[model samples]
Every structure is written in structure tokens, then in C-alpha cells.
Target chain A: MNDTRQFHLLAGLATGRDARSDDAIYQSLWEAIVEHRLSPGARLPEDALAGAFGVSRTMIRRVLQRLALEQLVTLRTHRGAQITSPTPSEARDVFRARRLLEGALLTEVVGNIKPADLQALAQIADQEHHASREQAIRLSARFHTRLMAMAGNASLSEALSQLISRTSLIIAVYGRGQAGCPCEHHTLIKLLETHDLAALQKWMHEHLTGIEASLDFTASGDALPDFEHLFGHHREQNAS
Target chain B: MNDTRQFHLLAGLATGRDARSDDAIYQSLWEAIVEHRLSPGARLPEDALAGAFGVSRTMIRRVLQRLALEQLVTLRTHRGAQITSPTPSEARDVFRARRLLEGALLTEVVGNIKPADLQALAQIADQEHHASREQAIRLSARFHTRLMAMAGNASLSEALSQLISRTSLIIAVYGRGQAGCPCEHHTLIKLLETHDLAALQKWMHEHLTGIEASLDFTASGDALPDFEHLFGHHREQNAS
Candidate 1:
């Protein structure tokens, strides 16, 4: 059940392509991290993973690269790959960008929402409110995904969803999930139902801020000095 | 010389990765379209490209997927991938998103601007102003990139850069290259040099609006009805 559930997330990334097995492998590795099977600072050796997944190192590296772009996996020199543990600074930046993005998305979509879309969103809100703590977090993330999907831009949808995914990982290590409540989702729905844009903006800003506040940013970082190796000596000189 | 020149663009995407070959392949395809050697509606067959690049279908597919993500390539079922000719709606949506994102990037970085960053940016502005029309367009795009990099969020910079890349393609197929002028770049630099956020915001909005105005959105789009194929029967039901 656990393995299958994890493949489900990978399937989201690979629905239409003719590469189900490859997608499965990518998601499997991703899921391992999501489930904490792959611990936060542990290195992912290409040879072992390639053998385990019955694929070439090239295939494993492909998945690792995709994950790295999402900031979920950090690829290191000679060191192979590791489950990314974002530094406090990185985490705050992600949250700030998401806040800006989600705010823009909400402003864009709230004006054009259809009745059926609202109905579906309401159902997701209900699921988010009633689900178990772990499931609730996933459902809550899905709420934002559903909202972004309504904007009708493929790239925007993908970008916002990836940000949500990374935010979930951030919350996993630094979260105080207890800070979230169904009342927050309900109020958002109410504002949406009324089509009150100002209220909607206020609610979302507060909601996102509350989430950001819940993260324990004081945790010490566990990042490798991979950027220096990736760019070499000249990168520092060129740094803005 | 041509091959070497193309890698310069790919270097933007591959600054951190170890795979020069993969980056080269991606930029080659990108430049082909950029130079109008491949028309907007041209098909990019995987097998032919794999042979041309002397790489596996997997490698070629990876490059194609990344391009598709950038909206430069459209992946079609049974028909393989083709260069994406975004519809008026898609083009407008992209411009809208870019306006929001670049505006946000400007807002985020304006408070943090340094003298050195401004000086380096002034060099890019000069390049944009004095270069040949072709090189000037590239430099103008680079100016925006250098501006965003100052914000210090790798993901945000990449996401915004990819959006700018797509916007460049949109302009290439539909633009009047003569529409851009040095006065605009100088105005932006003047605003930046003074740290006048309000004027900076106004100049960027008008600047982007001018670029968007130059595009012939009336150019009939050559998009396939492949969204239905990719999303299945229910996409229309849920369509916003």
C-alpha cells in the first residue's frame, strides 16, 4: 500500500508519457524520501540505486536531476545524490516565492471560477478538514493544487504544484502541523463563495503566513558545499 | 563556431550539471527554433534527432521533455514532438504570467540592490543598447536575467528565465525586431541607478507592455487539439 501510494505521486508527473516504468522509478525514489525511508541527509549512490531499480546509472541520474531541480534531492560531487534538507534561508525563500505566486494565482483565478470548479474545490476542502493529520496535510496541499489548476495555464499549474511539493517537504522536517485548522480552510471557502477578492487575499496571506510561522527555522542546516564544486573558482567572482 | 556559440545559451541551463553533451543537445534544438531555421509548426522527430545528436532516444527524449516544459516543444501522441506554436490564448497567458513574475522579481530584488550589481547590470544594458539587432534582443533578455539573479533564489531565477525564453520565442515568431530601442534600456537603467522603486515598477510595466504590444497575436496559431488527448475526456468537463 505504501509503495503503491508513493507511485501515485510519481504518476502525477508522468500521466501522459509512454514511460510508466521510468516514471515509477522516479516516483519510487521520490516517495522514499517523502516517507522518510530515505533520511534527510543520506547520500544516494547511483550504482546501488541503478542495480536496485534494474535500470542504468544514466536512468537513475535522470531521476536524480529532476528531483534536484525540485530541490527535493541535492546532487553532490563524486558524492552522488542526497535527499535535500533545505537550509533555513532556502526554506524562507521558497515560502516567500510561494506566497507571492499563490497570491498572484488567487487574484488571477478568483475572478473566473465556475460553479462546478467551486463545488469540486469545496469537496477538497472538506477532505482537507476531516482527514487524519498526515492525510490532512496532503489534502491541504491538494487544495492549493486544485486552486492553481483552475487558472488554465499548464506551465503555471506545474510551477505552482512543484512549489507546493517542496513546501510539503519543508514542512515535513520543520513543521508544526498542529498550527493548521479546518477553520482556516472553511473561511477561505466562504470568501471564495462570496467572490470577495479582498477578503480572499487577506485570508490567503494570513493563512500562508501562519504556515510559515509554524516552521522551526532555527534548525541547523545540513547542506554540502556542492555549489562551489558545480561552478568552480570563477563562480564566486561572478556572484551578484 | 556555430556549435560553440549555441552552448553559450545552454550554459544558462547547465551551470550546475556535469553533462555538457545533454546541455549541448538542448541548446542546439532551442537555437534552431530561435534562428527560424525551424519554423513554428515544424515537427521534431525523436528518432531523427537521436541519430543527429548521436545520442540514445532516451537522451533525446529527455531534451525534448525539457523543451516541452518550456513550451518551446509540444509533445504529441503517435505524432511525436513538434515546435509549439502557442495559440493567442496561450501567448497572452504566458505574457500575463511573465509580467506578474518579473514584476515580483523586481520588487523582491530592488530593496537588496548593490552598487556592484548595478554596475554589472549597466554593462549588460550597454550591450543591449549598442549590439546588432539580433545580439541586442539576446542582450535585452540577458538584462532581465541578470536583474533576477540579484534576487538570489535559484529556482525563482530559473523559473523566470524559462518564462522569458518562451516569451522570446513568442516574440520571434510574431515580433517586429525594430520595435525595441536603446532608449528603453537606458530608461530602465536610470530608474535602477536611482533606486526609484515606483518609477522602476512603472518603467518595467510599460516596457513589458510595449514588448507585448509588438507581438502579432493575430497570427493564427497552429496548435493541435492534443490537450484533449493528453488530459483525456474529463479535461473539458473541468475546464475553466
Candidate 2:
């Protein structure tokens, strides 16, 4: 909720890791964002993050740049970085993409799902039942990403992973006390075990559809641009 | 091709542009790479590129970092950056991803096809006919990306754009005297005019299949990674 609490969550994700590499920092920050510990529009000060992670500002800058590219973070010229708040249109785009991509990918997953794969997925679903709210949401994303990876297309998997991460941001912004997946992931796991292609695809479709339907798009207006912060440096240079 | 020739093509792309900003430099280098003017595994030295583009090496590094994120360029720790050479398996993955994503997206294009959209697509296809080989390949990628944009999903459009760019890399790697899309984009344009969803989907599937078929996957082995180049910095540190 606050920066200190958010950094604590990141520390938990980074526990037992002494030397925080780029990936470790990125993963910790990403988890905190997707888990809603770091709410949308929360500023990510370079010094704060660098101090929290015991890394240099250069390392934090690299991680921030990567996250900015993935759209989970927004970096302005002079305004610094913040967790991205997905617009209503971007939310719709993410859901539509998930349905079209995840639904189609389920067929490949159904065709080639091994028993071990099913077990691994079920384990994640089971873990979600006891996870904290943040952990549950992250696990939900992990479930979908892991399931889709069965289709074995690295490009789709990678792209969907980004969408999945953004879906967390969307849920944080528009969700009215609703979970990202709740119990639906377990049911989808069951459908995978059944191996009915039609059933699996149908469930995947309705599952994504149901999640999209639950979001309250009208609740949030687009964040007004900070024109002062945007042009303050230009004004200073001109005055000088 | 030589670095001089590659930089010349980049210069042409950057023509009439004095301020070679990051996007300008990125666009020029991206065009060169996708157009096959910059071959797979071509080294992109920072000093040479900075001199050619008249930008700081820092700016060039940022652009290269972006391309590296998109998988168009590979940046090693000590080896600097080079154009990505997608492997046989990676090529197959790209084709499969295209068939699934593009085939699904065409249905949306058919559902929302407009006369003007079709005309615009036709214009790109028309230009492809008269363009040189490199220009034609870039135009063909543009046509597919443009058509998919009509589906009205920014997430899918952005994801597909990355895949389309990588497809250019794939084609450069394994193409055996073949064009990226040749003349099939025109047929796709015609189908969009007709608004036949089923036909459009089928045509897309076969069109992608044909492109994948034309690639000579068996002809090239994965580039034996330069191990000495990979670990050269570590060895130098130890010796020091």
C-alpha cells in the first residue's frame, strides 16, 4: 500500500538472494506490481528502489527501462517512473487478445498435455487456494502462462506473458473486489485433464470472458497528464 | 554486406533528417535489418554506428537495447551487438505463431473491413510489385501489420508486429531465393474486399504455410556460438 510495505514485499521475493541481479530486481518489482502491493500510478523513485535492492542506480535504471518496454512501468522525460495504470481501452485490448490467443492455444495444450504437465498445473492451482491475495493473483498468472507454454510456441508464450502481467494492472485498476481468477483456474485444469478440445477451448473462452465482464471500466478516468512536470524543465531552460 | 554498405542504407533511411533521434536511428537500423540489407549475424559496432548516425554511442546503445528486447538484435556482454539469426526451430516457432495469430486476426479484419482500409492495403501491395527485393520484403511485412491493425486490438497488433519483424529475421536466415510474401498479399487484399471470413482464414493459413515451406531449415546449422568471444571478458579480468 505504501512504498515501505511495497519494498518489504519485494524483499520477501528477494529473500535468500544476496547479489540482486537485474533479473532478480526485475522479478521482485514485477511481482510487487502484479500482486497489487505496488498499486498503479505509484511512483518508483530511482534512489528508493536502488537503496531497497542494494543495487546501483544504473542497475535499477536498466530494470526500469525493461519494465517500461513491457508497459508495466511508465517512464516520463522528467517525471520519473511509475507503475502503469492501464486505460479502459487497453484493458479491453488485453482481454480480447487473451481470449483469441489463449483460446486457440488451448487446443495445442489439449493435444499434447502430458500427465506431468497436468500435475504441475494442478499443483499451482492448489497452491493458489492458500496463497495470500497478492500471491494468489501471481499464481493465477503463472497458471495461465504455464498452461499456454504447453502449446510450445515461444513467441506466443512470451507475448502472452506480457499480456498476463498487464492483466494484473487492469484488475488492480478496474476490479471491484473481484479476484483475477478465483476458482476458475482449477476448473480449467480439470478440463485439461478431460482432453476434450471443444470443452477446453470453450472453458478458456468463457473464463477470459468472465474475467473481462467483471471489470468496471466506467469507474476510472484516464489519468490527466502532468503538464507542469512535463514542461517544467523546458521552462527552466528558457528562463535561464 | 560490408558495414559501409549497411551504414549507407541506414543513411538513406535517415535522409533529410539532421537530428538522428533514438526512434529515427532505430527505424533506420530496423529497416536495414528487416530488409536484408543487414544480414543475419552482421556485427553492429557502436563506434561505427555512432559515427554513421551522428549520434552518441549512448543513444545508439539505447536503440540497440530496444532492438535486443524485441529479439531482432542479440547483444552479448563483451561481443557487442549483432543481427539475430533465428534458428531452424525458432523459424518453425515463428511460422506456427503467425498461422495461429494471423489466421485468427483475419476473421476480425473481415468482420470490420472497410472500402478505404482495403484500398490502403491494396496500395501497399501495389507498391510491392514495383519495389526492389529488399523494399518489397519490408512492404510485405508492412501489409500484414497494417491489415492486422484493422482488427482493432492494439495488444495483438503490437505483439504481431514484433513477430512480423522477427519473421523478417527468420526469412533472412533461412530463405532460399524466396520473397517474404511475394504476391500473396494482393490476394489477401482481394479477400478483404470480398469479406469472406472463411476464405480469408483459409487463405491466411495456406499463405503462411507456403512461406514456411519455402524456407530451407535443413540447410543451415545453428551458428556455433563464439565461446571465446563469450568468455573473453571474464578471462581478461582473471588475467588482470
Candidate 3:
């Protein structure tokens, strides 16, 4: 499989434009974990990743540490890091937190959005509408994040960004849908343009509810991969 | 000055309710910076801090790195670390961020608070009213943080907590008031208890406005102590 091509595909979706190596790597790894390409309990060895990316261990370590801090990767005592694989309860908690934070942010923005801000959002929605399935999915996710950024709260924006990233990861792992439907975005933009606060709030609440309802949380029962072999190169481990 | 006693005094105000070496070191240095005990542009040497804390240099380094990440302390390229005196633009951004994020969170909590939650909030408000001036200020801060917590958004709560802490630090340096009164808390709690969403939002907006109004940003032209020397003992640098 062409990992790099797959990464580019995901990265293009995330940014609505071509992304650099660091962002591509980060987004690719993030999506892989969320989509179960890198399943929970799978190891991520720095040296192996460095070799794969043709980058320094230092760069890979920085990205890994960032993920670890987000609680998407668990850094064990001496065992190295693995995908978080949030428990059912943690997954529920994540959504609950999102509902409170993002929902409130959306409501506030609905009341205060400027025409210029709406224009920017419309541009993103238009881009999503025309993108490929994966690109569309990525843009759909970024839409809400971009809205948070526009709200002008760095702290809130940072937290929401993390949550949104994690949510994408969760959807990648468990989502079962056509990735590129811009229907929700269309509705949201219309509400914003009209300055209908009540309608906007209702639409946002339903949108999140729809997203949450779409997850397939039933255990897939897929066989777990070998951690050492998956993380360390198969040939390298055998040669050693 | 009894450093340990001073440590205890500040530690009592921090969330832990117990003063460990690291917490003591963090609180003391944080206060020193916020209180202008350690002025901006002063250097902090590890060896000096180690001697002052009666701990190893490793401990000092860890604390310094954490503060650097929070942007409370600046780790210069070759010049070493010092308290971060935020630029005027940065300071304005912080307040702007706070108003948008906290204002939204408060509005949501007010609209959605339950009777049980109101009771808990009342208890905290009562405690704030009866506590010491310093304790009251801390408790009042906690009351807002607790509201975020009850809203059940971990991400929002964490972000707001960090912002509140940084704001408190900023206020310590630039605010005219030496102590925070309980009047605001009382008013906020009353609004929450009444379950009047419109009134609650108004109260929160005004409360934050009042806080921003109290800041004295003009330079006092007071000669401040060296930041490095406040945490660093003169003997240790000479010994080294």
C-alpha cells in the first residue's frame, strides 16, 4: 500500500490545500490511529517512524509527545507509546464534553458572526462540497474548528481543536458513512447568513447528535496485529 | 524572610491544599513574577534556584520548563529563562480570549444549571464569603472553575482554568486592587439561583468588564528586584 499517497489524501482533506511534511505526517498518523490502521495497543517506535519518514528521531518524538499529551497516545513507563483506544466511557465523556463546549461556542458565534466570517465559512463549505470523499470528510471536520478559531479564544480554540482532532480519530475508527456530504454545512451556513440564532442552535445541536448517532461502537473483533513487528520493521527485526 | 512560611501561605491558596517542594517552588516563583518580586528581563539560574529550594537542580529545571510551556516564563535561546512579561498586544489578546470563551461558558451554565448544581454553587459561594481575604480570592476563582467543571466539559474547564490562572497572574502584576471581594460571586450565584438566563449573562459580562476596568496598566516607575536573584541565591552562582 502507498502510505505516502494515503497520507497526502488525508492531509489534503484536513487543510483544504496541500500540507507540508510535518502537518501531513501528523494528520496521517492521527487518521491512521482513529481509523484503526494503527489500532489501540499498537506500538509506535520512534526509530521506525524516523526511518519511514526519512526524518530525524527528534521530529518524530516531538509529534509523538504532542499526541501523548492529547491522551490519544499512551506513553507507558518503559514500554514506549501506543494508540489510546479510549474506553466506551471515555468516548462518551469525550462527546459530552464536546456537546457542552462546541455547542455553546456555536450558539455564541451564531449570534455574533460577521458577514466576512460567514463568507469565509461559505468558502470552506464550497470547498468541501467539491472535494473527494476523504477530502470532504476532513473539511467537514475543519469547518467547526475554523469556526472556533474565528471566535477569538485561543485557549478555547486549542481545547476545541484537540477535541475535534480526537473526534475525527474516533470517527475514522468507527464511522460508517459516505465521507463527503455537505448537507449539514449547507444548513449551517444558511443559518449563519440569515442571523437566525434559534435555527442555528437547533441545527448545530442536531448536527452533533447526528454525528454521534452514526458511530458504530460495536467491537469489530478484528484480530490484533503483532506490536513488535508492526512497530519495528519486519525485516529489520528478523535480521537482528 | 521565612521562605517555608511564605511557601505555606501561598500553597494554601493553590488547589493542592498541601505544599510539596515542587508546588512550593512553582507557587513562590509564580507569585514572585506576578507580584513583581521577580521583575521581567531577570535571569533564573538553575544552581541558584536549587540552593534556594534546598533541592536538586533537576527539580528546578523541570519546574522552569513547565512554566516556559505555559508562557509564564520565557526560555531564551542562550540567555536562559526569565518571567514572561507579556507584550501589550499579547495581554490584550489574553483578555479578549477570556471574554469570548468564559462569557459563552457562563451563559451556557446559567441556562442549563440544575437545582442540585445551584445548591453546590451556593455552598462554594458561602465558603468564599467566610474565608480569609486571600483564601476568598482563591475560592472565588475556584467558584468559576467549578462552574465549568459542573458544565461537564473537561476540555473547556482545563482551558479556562489555565486562562484564569494566567489572568490572576496578570492581575497580580497590573491590577490596582490588592484583594478580590466576594461581591461578584454573590451576584453571580444569585443570578444562577434565579435561573434567569438573560440576567445571568448580563451579570457575567458586567463582572468581567469590572475586572478589566480595574487594571492599572501605566508604568509605576518603581525599581523592581532582579528575577534571577529572587529565586537564585548569590552564594550558589559564586560557588559554581
Candidate 4:
């Protein structure tokens, strides 16, 4: 897909704007990376990204630096920037961290969950059921992030969301077919509706463990993805 | 105090270096803020900091940006950067986050605690006991951060560490006299030695809650600190 069309789809933009906010730019790139449209180990050339986003290279660099801080992107001394390829060990650490965090966060979720939160989660689950693989993966991250946000702890929710994003990088590296449990989210929503913290925690632990288990760590890494193919269309559009 | 002297003491440097790595610069400034050497609401002027660190404004700006990402510093449009003066609500959110994270993380710490880990913690507690109040506060943060790192989850450790640093900022704004529980680290170390996970988690929760309770959120905001006094010494030295 062309850059504008892809951004429109990924960012869910109704109409094109001349210049995007830093957050809008970050969100677009973040969603693209997490949804696996931008593969792990893909080079994010600043010039091409600037061209695509119709912004300065400096703006692109700022977004990349923020992503690097979240561990979704790797910035090297001279090598510039690339999507982080989470090592098998790093992948396991991410899952273990999630199990501990998301599992513990259930107490707060149970304490604070309301009908509206349940409805919100159920809606995400429903969307996940019908999305394409990429969209489903993105929706699944949204599901967990949204569920955890109901806990009313912004710090925990923010940290967990970063982990959720990194999970996409893990899936990019080692996923065989599924990046997230598309069907299982509905089950989670059902469990949440019950307000059984133990059951919810148990289910979350098993669910994350299952997703981790399903990954093929034996899967090899990606070769550098084609940035030109990804953003060349935008560069052309910008030039025109 | 002079910036060089402050850096020397805060970073514990034995010798002066011609240049500091970004991490080194970040570490020095981070320690200063968390120790309350750099008060909340203190302006971190780029030119002054660049001179103090003997680096380019660009390098100083990068360090400031990193600090901003961690929420220990706030960067504003046209206003430049300053130490973050967290609102009372933000302070409470930070404590709540720590209670959830550190308390939950104790399970992993208990599972992973070895004699060396305990020894390392005890050493920090020992230092805290002998250190000045500022040093003690910094050591206390080190104590908790080091303790959490034993959980063996880098992501959680990193996330919790940021919260711990922000806790310092919270103390800066709302703290009455104590920044951290200077005397409690030894107690926590003793609890760790007992290997009682539940008790350890309980102590951690109470410990963080107590610190939060001690803060006087009614405290007035800081006046814009005298940057000329804080960094001007280094400017003169640089010119010489």
C-alpha cells in the first residue's frame, strides 16, 4: 500500500491533514510496527519516513528516539535505526513480565471494572474476531491495554502497554501464524464480566503462557526489509 | 555549589573527564534530582548544563530529553526544560504504581534471592545508614531499584526504576523533611533475609505508603530556582 493510504488505514484518518502532531506521527509509526506491517529488523530510513509523513527528518528522528526508549526500535551509534528484533531471551522476559504485571493488575481491574469497561472490552474482542491477522494482532494489544487501563493505575497501564507493543515485535520474530489469541479475547471479556479475580488472573497467566508457548523460537530473523518499497510511493507523492 | 563539584560528588567521580557519555551525564543529573540536589521546578537551561558537563548544547539537550521521557524532567515549548514538579495527584499515582509493582515484584525477588543479592542489598542499606540525608535518599532509591532488579525481569525493573525516580520528584514537591524512609532500608533488608514473601510484600506496601503519607501536599510550589547560582560557577571555570 502507498504511504498515505497505509497511514489512513492504520491511523483511521477520515481526512488528510497537512502536518501531523508528534503524537499522531508516533502513533502511526507505532501501530504500523506493532501490527507487523513494518517487520522486525526493518530499516526506518529517516529521509523516506520524513517524505512519507511530510515532515522534517528531525521530527522523524524524535519519534524514532521515543520508540527506541520503549524498546520497539533499536538505535545504533552509526547504523541509524531499525525495528528491534527481540531475542528469544528478551521475548521470554517480556512474557514473564506480562504474566506478573497483568496477573497482578487483575485485582485492580476487578475492583474498578464497570459495565462500560466490560462493554468496551467486549467490543474490542468482537473486532478482533473479524480483523485480518495484522489488524487482529493490533486489536488484541488494544484489548489487553484497554482491560488493564480499567485498573485505574495509569503508570501500570502505560508500562503494560509498552510490553503489549513489544509483544508484537516478539511475534514478528517468532510467530508461526498467530500473533495474538484472536478468539481467546472473548473468553477474557467473559471472565472479566464475572468479576472473579482469581479466575481472571489464572486465565491471564495461562493465556499469556499459551501465546508464548505457541511461538516458534526456532524461527529465524528477518533480512532488512525494503524501506524503498514501503515508503518510495510517499517519497514520489511528496516530490510531486 | 559549583556544577563540577556537584557532578563530582553526585556521580562519585574521583577524577575529572574531558567528556561524559550520555549515560554518564544522565546518571549524574538523575542522581542530583533524585537526591534533591536539583530541586523540583529548577530550570535546566541547556547552555548552562552544556557548559557544566563540558559538552555541546545538543548533547545536553539529548540528556534532558531522556530525563523528560522518564518524567523526572519536563520540557516545555519556548520555556525550555525544568525538573518536574509532580502534582499531588501525580505523586499519589506514583506511589500507587510503586505499591502495585514493588509489592507484586517481591514474589519474584523472593524466588530469585541469593546470598549475594541479599549482601548487595545489605550493603546499600549500610551505606544509607551512614550517608547524609540526600545521599541516604539516593541510596534508598538504589536499594529498592537494586532489590527489584533481583526479580530478573529487565522490563519490570526498568519500569519500576522510572517510578522510583519519579518518587524522588514527588518527594521534592511534597516531602516534609524525609525524601525516602532513610531508616527503613535496613528493616527491609532484614525482611528479605527472612525469605517471607508475604511479609516482605506487606512491608514494601506499608513502606511506600508511609513515605507517601509523610509528604505535605499542602506545600507551596517552588520559586524559579536561581540558575545563575546553580550553574554560574561552572561557566566561570569554563571561561578560565
Off by over 4 Å in 3: A1-40, A50-62, A103-123, A126-135, A177-180, A217-240, B1-71, B74-81, B86-139, B183-203, B217-240
Cα-based RMSD of the predictions, in order?
7.8, 7.9, 12.0, 11.9
Residue B113 of model 3 has an lDDT of 78
lDDT of 1 by residue, A1-240 (tens): 113332334334434443346567776666556544565777777766665555577777777877886778887767778888877777887888888888888887887789888888789878866666655666677778888888777667777777777776777668754635566777777788888788887888888888888888655445545565567778767874
TM-score of chain A of 4: 0.86
Q: Score the docking of each candidate (DockQ).
A: 0.35, 0.67, 0.22, 0.53
**Model 4: per-residue Cα lDDT at residue B214:** 89
- The parts of candidate 4 lying over 4 Å away from their true place are A1-19, A221-240, B1-15, B220-240
At residue B46, give the lDDT of candidate 3: 71
- Which portions of model 1 miss their true places by more than 4 Å? A1-39, A42-63, A77-80, A176-180, A223-240, B1-20, B27-38, B45-58, B176-179, B223-240
DockQ of 3: 0.22
TM-score of chain A of each: 0.74, 0.88, 0.74, 0.86
Candidate 4 lDDT tens digits, A91-181: 9989999998898888888989789988988898899888888888899899999998988878788899999999989988898874577
Residues B147-201, model 3: lDDT tens digits = 7776565656666776766666566566775566577777777777777877766
TM-score: model 4 vs. ground truth: 0.84
In order, candidate lDDTs are 0.72, 0.86, 0.66, 0.82
Cα lDDT tens digits, model 2, A43-153, are: 998877876787777888888999999999999988999999999889999999999999888878877889888899999999999999889999999998999899988
lDDT of 1 at B89: 76
Candidate 1 vs candidate 4: which has greater TM-score?
Answer: 4
DockQ of 2: 0.67
**Best prediction by lDDT:** 2
Each prediction's fraction of true contacts recovered: 0.29, 0.86, 0.32, 0.71
